[model samples]
Target: MDFLSTYKGGLLVISHDLPLLDESITSVLAVEHGTLEPFRGNYSYFLAERERRREQRIRERKHQDEKIARLEEGIRRFKGKTEKMAKRARSWETRVEKLKAQRTEISRRGRQVAVRFPQPPPSGRTPIKAQGLAKAFGQNVVFVDVDVDIDRGERMIIMGLNGAGKTTLLRILAGVEHADIGEVELGHQVSLGYYAQEHEQIRAGDSVLDHMRTVSALPDRELRSILGHFLLADKVDQDAGTLSGGEKTKLALAQVAVGAHNVLLLDEPTNNLDPQAKEALLDALEQYEGTLILVSHDTDFVEELAPDRAILMPDGATAYFDESMLDLVALA
Candidate 1:
């Protein structure tokens, strides 16, 4: 934020990071309901002004509706009387029609993104157990002698500094990548769902609907219905590679949601989400009756999810989650 505020060049930042916008931005160009509108202040100012405008429009619309209703009522009562009364009724009808035509469309408040995870099937008490897990790339050892035991219906967070192998660990648990020396076992009736931070699972050259098909064998109608909940229904035919970062995040989450898996391995799941979407995801995860192993740098998300346990990386130490561990999460 400091650097962006200090830079002399023309700046156009497209981000959901509210604090960054509040500190660095001087104006906002909002694209809402297929219209581009500019506000001459920061994001906070734009939110306030936008709400004020919506409220004003709603008030005006209510007044217009009342006026039209009254005119219609007058027309109904006067049209059955004498010729002059009928003429008056006709005039009222004309006024009602004109008022209806001139009524401005009220801008709707933004809808919150719906992110509901389906209840997964039951698994054994200990859904996952990893022993002596280790990974490395060339000379840089990510972690060694790591052990993990995730109980069913438990939430566990992975915390570490950047490059401390948080994401790598999650990928290993998800079976997307192999550990250098260890074995990960799933207990009886356990299924896995993985949400990759980079969205590498979403294939290029495929439409949004196509990706859903790969992850789930449900009918197209059902798949589109799931996509609709994630606000991606309209983008069904759009190429997955062309989606924005936030859209990709939604797609990846949607993919995870449809598997009906008993365990979830999530890496930075909250990365590109807007505030409302993030809140919705938090609410959904809070209600999910499944084991979760999460790797995230989002402090508020980690705190809100309130994982039952935490696995610190590099050294791969296990500990019951406490308030003190939040500091390490913040640093991540």
Candidate 2:
């Protein structure tokens, strides 16, 4: 909003929400690259404007191609760089860089939204099964007979207030900690990727890239492309120990995103993220075609990626039910 001009320069806003743009903007600039079409009204007008621009772009692209051909011929004849041409090219490149930086900032913002994309999961495929599973810490019994089955693409959310043993359940599932009493079954094809709240599992002395390459045993070329998806490309050279809590969390998620993990066990995945980053995390989970077993307090996120089953542990006994965030809150 700050970027919008106080005077008269037209603002070019890129958003999927038309109503949002309609309310804030007076005019629209519909651009399809080779040509630009101006609209007198807001987003509604912009839709028609865009169609007009597309047609214009089709026509203009022919001329644009011819112009590029001529310029390339001139460039070829010139052979080497002249002082004036070099200075002009440098100025244009600087402007291009600045525009790219701005576009990156805007693209990051575009990923955030109140309404989420409904990413479909695969058909029924069980990843984990627990029969008469039980755990007790000291004298306080967490659960006695906990029986559950987690399937592929099934979103299972484990929820409880502070000190409600959600972490213990996740640890048991990940095989990081032993379940005190019964038989727990993990499917043969399941590959586990865990993001613990403490983040103590990842080695601290290595660079972010080194950690990924060493831990996942992925090649250097693949590591760069994978880390790029989580906004970790630039931070690849930085040491893991030097990263902030959010960076560490992001890096942890990046590893899971790139690796072969059919079963994802996440504890407070959004803890260190800002609102925008939280949206990104939700987007990732929503798009992920895997079995998700997560512990979260984010109601919006929980609702967006609704759990197939919810395990609520409050006071003492375990309550297995299908409940939305509002219903759970009302029960509370």
Candidate 3:
């Protein structure tokens, strides 16, 4: 923000950080209905003006709807009554058609998923522990000598750059990929749930409904109700491979919810989610009582999670989380 504020050049920053937008931006260019509309102020000002415009559009739509209704009624009452009456009715019908063609649709708010994780069964005080975990892919060594322990209900975030082995570390811990050396040990009665950013857990041949059923034994009615909350009720029968990126993300989360796992390993869980869905996921995670170890590039998400500890990759350094670590989280 300081750099952007001082730079004497035009800048385009794409971010969801409200504070950053408020502090750094002079104007906002919003994409609405496939067009970029400029608002000459910060994010807050832009939001207020956008809401005002939306309300005005809605009022106009209502007025147009009433006019169209009256025109249709006039046409129905006059048609086939007499030649002149029929001609007047035709004119009214033409006017109605024109108005309908020119009518503007009211902008719709983005849909938000009602995400809720199932209550996980009780687990031991320390649900997960790693001792000198190491991983290397051929010539490239990602991380080595990493040791960490996760207590019950603790939230931990793994931070690093793009190739900093964040995802690799998560995969190793989840047992999706084997570490080159060392091991990740699970405590007693720990049910683990892994959410992969690549959607590797979702089988291509299975339907969304089938995936949910594989994770849980919930009845059809209950399962469908849960799917409805994630806006997947209509797509239950669709092949999981055919779903959009966002749809796949939602399905993966749905699988996690049904698993009732006490330990969650999430790798870039916020990837491909729109603003509303991201908020929904964040809200759900905030309420979750399970042990969480996550890899995320979204600083806002990490901030909201309020992780108690952080594991930095490459060198595999573990440290208590503080505001200073947020800079590395942002870079991640």
Query: lDDT: which candidate is best?
Result: 1
lDDT, model 1: 0.90
Cα lDDT of candidate 2 equals 0.68
Q: For residues 1-332, write the lDDT of model 3, one tens digit per residue.
A: 67887999989987766777899899999976677889999999999999988899999999999999999999999999999999999999889999999998876785569999877888999998989888888888888898878899998989889998888888888888888889889899999999998999788988989998998899988889899999898999999999988889999998988888998899888877767888999999999999999998788878888898998887778888988888898885
* Predicted candidate 2 versus true structure: per-residue lDDT over 1-332, tens digit per residue: 33453546655676533334667688876544344656888887777766665567566655655555555555455435887776665565555455444431111112232212223333347778887777888998877677668777878888777776788878888888888997668876777778887877567788999878765676888787667766667888998888877778778877766665777899988766655677777877777777888888766667777777777753323344444453552232
Model 3 TM-score?
A: 0.78
* TM values, all candidates: 0.86, 0.60, 0.78
Judged by TM-score relative to the true structure, which candidate is superior, 2 or 3? 3
Q: Model 2 compared with the native: what TM-score?
A: 0.60
Sorted by TM-score, highest first, which candidate order results?
1, 3, 2
List the pairs of residues colliding in candidate 1: none
Using TM-score as the measure, name the better of candidate 1 and candidate 3.
Answer: 1
